[model samples]
Structures are given as structure tokens and as C-alpha cells.
Target chain A: MPRRSFELMETHIPSLRRYALVLLRHDEPLADDLVQDCLERAMSRWHLWRRPGNLRGWLFTILHNIYVNDVARAVARPDVVEIQDYFPAMAVPPNQADRIRLREVTAAIQELPDTQRQTLLLVTMEGFSYDETADITGVPIGTVMSRLSRAREKVRAASWGETRENGRRIT
Target chain B: MSDLPEIPTEDEIQALVDGRLDPARRAEVEAWLSENPDEAARVAELRDISGAVEQVYGHLLERPIPARFQNAAAPSMARSPVWRVAAMIVLVAMGAAGGWFANDAVGPGGDPNVNLARGAVKAHQMYAREVRHAVEVPASEEAHLVAWLSKRLDAPLRAPNLDVQGYRLVGGRLLPASDSGPAAQFMYEAESGERLTLYVEQNLTGGETAFRFTEYDDVSAFWWKDGPLAYVLIGRGGRDSLLTLARATYQELNP
Candidate 1:
């Protein structure tokens, strides 16, 4: 058995969890459960893990695949939730203004079409390079670039409280 | 080098904001930004959004690993509910005599304590990374977890209070302690999402104990035996940080 490789899988859990969280939009419990599923699959197929390349990217690709096949495939894409619901009702104020802004940013992120959100978080939050992000998301590098660019522009507009009508269309 | 690259494209600009731009092209982008105030501000906004996203969720990295994700070594070990409850009760009643038998069943290395420490660290590494199932039972059922784990390890188990240190009990889970017998892993999480695990197992034979510290991978674990229990405190922090928590655990349990 690939014993050392098994142990190495443990190291990637934190990053996988974070990526799962971002993809799931702050839904902590679901994100974590998804991570568990992803790790379980990776461990079972330890021999299949391509060494000398980006293991983190490989793990992420597995997670995104599971999500697409099992979860996202069933659940219809979620529409932008009420902006107020974006911020937890219990979140108190010293961070209130920032929280509200963050909520808007997240909602804008949530508002993104599924493909864009997936591409955007993989690049911006997880720090996956264009090539790696493309591999994980199973898209061309140019697509990853365009989706990320569009995602960023949307988030920028959201942060500034501008509506989509004011946003420029990307060619 | 003197020639300007075809007015760095939009993708190039986005690459700059994402920190993915090649250094060679980066200088061109910077020169481009310096010349264009509006575009620089846009890049600045993108950078802020990235920072805020990290700020919002970075703590997830530090949160305790849930029980469901702990045993990555054997995903099949996760049993159905009826089996889980029955196993919890039966494992404790059996008193890890099986593990004891297996201990001699395998060859011994020098210092049984070191072997125990290794088992402790292994358990720590596995369960400390979980989020949803960090513990076999959640803290809401604190009474049951204590009673169950106490019975299994055959030690009087009390969840240590590390409130002064800003760590609160998240929950505890049952772990196989290799040859030392079945062990209990108690998890605690700080407000900032940092986690610490205390691994407890029955000390089959009593001996004098002192704090012994070691590290595995990136995790630092401190273990010592006292009376009937051998304890290992593990976390991904410096030795000093783990020592402080280990000392706190010792005092709480010993007191």
C-alpha cells in the first residue's frame, strides 16, 4: 500500500475544506461533509494520485467532480439569496459594516453563474494557478481566465454597490 | 526589454490582481498601472475583495476536525447508527483487552511510552483535521461522551476546561490506541478556530511520568503518563504552545 502517500492526504484536508466552504457559500456543515467525502475517495484510490504534480489540484478536482455528479446535479442552481440573509442575523456590530459589505460581496459571488463562481474561488481564494484551476474545473485555460475576469468584475461592482446594468459586458 | 508589450490585455490585468502574473509581464503591468490611475484603482479593489474573502473564512483552517473525517485510514470503519452505539458501549466494557493482547502480539520497541506517543500523534493527525464529525459524539451529548469514553478507556474521564486559555470543548471520540488499548480523543476549539486534542488511554501498568514532547509531520504532541492514564496533547503549534496546553490538561485532570 502507498503508506506515506496516505499520510500526505491528511495534509490537504484543510485546504480542501476551505475550498469546499467557498464553493458551498459559507454553509459550514455541508462544506465539511463534502470534504469528508472527497478525502474518503482520495484515500481509497491512493495509488491513482499522480505524484510529482499538484496533489492539491488533484484533490480539488475530485471534490468538484463529486459535487457536480452527486450534489449540484440534483440541486437546481440557487438564485441570489436575500442580501440581508447573506449576513448571519446573529452577527453583532463592531464588524457590522464590514460584515454587510462582505455579505454583499458573497451574495455577488453567490449571484455568479455556477461556472464563474467555481472558477473564481479556485483562483482567488484557493490560490490555484490558471492551469491548475482549469484542470480542476475541467475547462480550458482561456475559459478559466474569462470566468475569473467576469467574476472579479461582478464582485467589484457588487462591492461598490453598483447594479449589473452599470457593469460592462465582457466579450 | 525597452519595448512595451501590446498594452497588457484584460486577462493580464486580471492576472495581476490575482497575483498570477509572470514577473516579467508583472513589471509591464505595473508600468501600465502607473500610467493609468483608473485601472490601478480597479486592481486595488480586486485585491481588497480577495483580502476580505480570506478574512471572512480563514478561521475554517483552524477549526477542529470533525469525527466523520478523522479515520481517513479506514473510511469503511464508519458504521451505521445501531452499530455505532453498540460498539461504543461494548468497546468500553471489553476494556481494550484485545489491544493489550495484540500489543504483545507485535514486537515491542524500546520504551512502551514512545510507541504510545506515536499512536497518540497518529490519532491526533487523523481526527484533528475533521470538521463535521470531529467527535464521535457532539458536546451537546457531553454526559454520554464522558460516560462512554470513560467506560471504554476504563479511566475516569473528565473533559478538561481550558477557558482561561480560550479553548472550549468541541467534543470527544473513541480511537484505537494500537497496542495501548482503545483511546479517547477529546477535541477543543479556540474562538479563532484553532483546535487542540487530548488523547487519553488506560495505562495498563503504572509508572512515574513526566512531560515528553515530540512532533510528527507538522503536529506537535506532548504526552505523559500518570496513575492509570497516559495522556497525549496534540496540535499544530510550536512545542511551547502545546506544552502550555498539556500542562493545563494535566492540572485539570489531575486536580
Candidate 2:
């Protein structure tokens, strides 16, 4: 492919990262690396281009494979996130506390079970259609629905000061 | 007092919020949701998770798209001499009506080798030529410098003695790796703006050493490796001077 094709790849990166960040939550930098690896593979395998119906879907499939492989590799060699490896230049901005609270919510979301979080973020953050979520998660459409429903319930229960019992909202 | 089915059917209604339902199913779901206010309310809350999720992951969004990413899609990674040289081939490859790029590396956050080199070069340029802010820790205390940088990088390191090259050891600092991993830039300056820097980081791609001199516009960089660790020496000087700086850097770093 020409340079323009590479440019197209560049354009789609944010969406790809939005998806990858949620999949491999917390270790966002690692997610960036994973996304890079996937793109490089896609570049080299440009010949493997059959022009699938959904190009974005195919790319995400590659990303998914890469993340799964990385998670496997990480088992033997743990990747610890060291926060103080670098010093910050910017002073904490006004309402930095809001960001901290946001980070807490994010952390809480990260703490959600992998399945639930993935389902919620895929259907929510990325705004993937349920079919796309099912395809990305490799689950049946019905399963995707249940997982997302449960994910929403769980996150709301924990974060919104509410709970569900007997399939009904308490408040 | 109710005859309840096995499943509450909220799952189906939630799927409707997700836009999973086909026409008939969707219509049915909306009707069901209309009657079930409580289920509808919970779905609404869950639906808002989208914005919350964006807030969580969006810090990175607000963070300036680092120059690395910008540089990649910018003119260089987008259009390089290599690309210019291979234009004929790449065009023919494209002319055949071709390509669905994974858009992974090239994608929104996928900054390429050019950007990576630019990052390495920018760091080297920024630190090496610096005087007052040159080193976070001046080279007077080599022990503390080595200890601190080594501890950060989690590897033994020695700021190579470039005194022979007239580039005295100014000092070194632990800098954020544009992406991840720890990055250290050793700064040195002669009587001129002729500063040289050795930028090192853990293998990002885990690929073999990309031992090539890449010039993104005017800035020149020579990158190589000794195994897993990747090294990029960036400076504006001529090739010979750069080689001298690189050799001294490699020898000191190795020995």
C-alpha cells in the first residue's frame, strides 16, 4: 500500500485505542504498544487484505488477538506499572480533585470483572453496536446482551449508591 | 401475586438500550420498558456509563496528542524519503485497487518509527544542548546520578566519560518515556551548540535493533542496540562526529 493507506491507519487510531484501553485497562501504555504491534502486523500483512466487509472489525480482531497473546506473555513476566518513574512538569490544575474522583471511577470500572467491563465499554464507550460487541467479544448476541446488562447493573450498583434485588431497582 | 417467568426479561430490554434489538424486538422492548419504570431507570443509569467511561479514559484524550503521534501522521511518517523512493512500487501496489490497513500503528494513537525517532531526537536535542536545565542532576556526583537513573531504569548504567571528545559529562535525568518504560537521556555539550545525547529505553517492539540513520526533516538520529535495549543517539552534527559520540557512548555504556 501507498503512504495514504498508512495515513488512513493513523486516522483510526483513537477509536482503536479507545477500545484497547478498555480491554487492557489500567496499563494504557501497554495498550498503546499492543495497538502498535497490531498495526505493524497489519502493515506487513497488507497482502492478507481480502477487503473484508468491515475493515475496522478486522483490525479490531487483530487487536483482540494481540491483547490476548500479551496477557498470556504477561503471566510469566509481570508488567508492573511504576508511577514515579518520571516527574510531572505541570502543577496540579484547578479542580484536579475532579480528575482524581474521575480516576477513582475509572479505577472502579477497571475493577469490574473482565467480561462485564468489556461488555459495558464496548457497547458504551466505543458505541459499538451489539452485533459488533458480540463479534469483538466472541460471544453470542444473547450472551452479549446479558453480560452488558449485568455489567451496567454492577457498575451502577457500586458507583451510584443503589442496588438491585429480585430484578428490580431498590431506589 | 404474580406468575413469573424464569428470566425477568430485563436482559432483553437492556439489549434494546444497546441497540441490539431488531425492529420487531426493539418495538417490543420499548413497550416493555414503558411499563417497567424501575428497569427503565436502571437502564438509563447504565446508559450513562458511556459518558462516565469516556471521562475515565478521556484524560489521555485531553493530554496533548504527544508530538510522537502528531509527528507520525504529520508529513514525515506520512511522507518519507523511503515512501518517496518507494513511491513507484507502493503506487503500483495501490494502483491495482488495493489495501485495508489495520490502521493499528497508523491509527489514532499509532505513531510510527519516524515519530519514535523524532521523539528520541527531540529529547536528545532538548537535553543535550541545554545548559542550566541540562541535567536534573549534574555529573559532579556520578554515584548518585548512576544510582538514581539505574534504579529508575532497573538496570546498571554509567554516564560514559565523553571528556576525550571535549564533551564533558554535564549530567543525566530520568525522563518519561513518551509512552511507557523508563527513558534516560545523558546530556553533553562542547564549546559549541554541538551537544550529543544517548537516549535508551527497553525494547518497545522487541524487534531486532533498527540500526539506521533516520532524519526526520533536519534533525539527524542514529539508533542501534546491544540486545533487548534500544539506543538512539541524536544530534545535529555531521555523521563522523555523531559516530564518535555514539562510539564513546556505547563503549562507556558497555564497559
Predicted structure with the largest lDDT when compared to the true one: 1
The local distance difference test score of model 2 is 0.58
* Candidate 1: residue B135 lDDT (0-100): 83
Candidate 2 B-chain TM-score: 0.53
State the weakest 10-residue window (summed lDDT) of model 1 chain B.
Answer: B85-94
Worst 10 residues of 2 chain A by lDDT: A81-90
- Model 1: residues >4 Å from true position, as ranges? A2-5, A76-96, A161-171, B1-5, B75-255
lDDT of 2 by residue, B1-255 (tens): 133222337666676666666786666666666777877776776665655565445444334333233323222211111211111111111111111122234432455344455567668766665557888888788789889888887767667777755777677888777467788887777777567677777656666542456554345666765555667777765543464455446556554
- Candidate 2 CAPRI category: incorrect
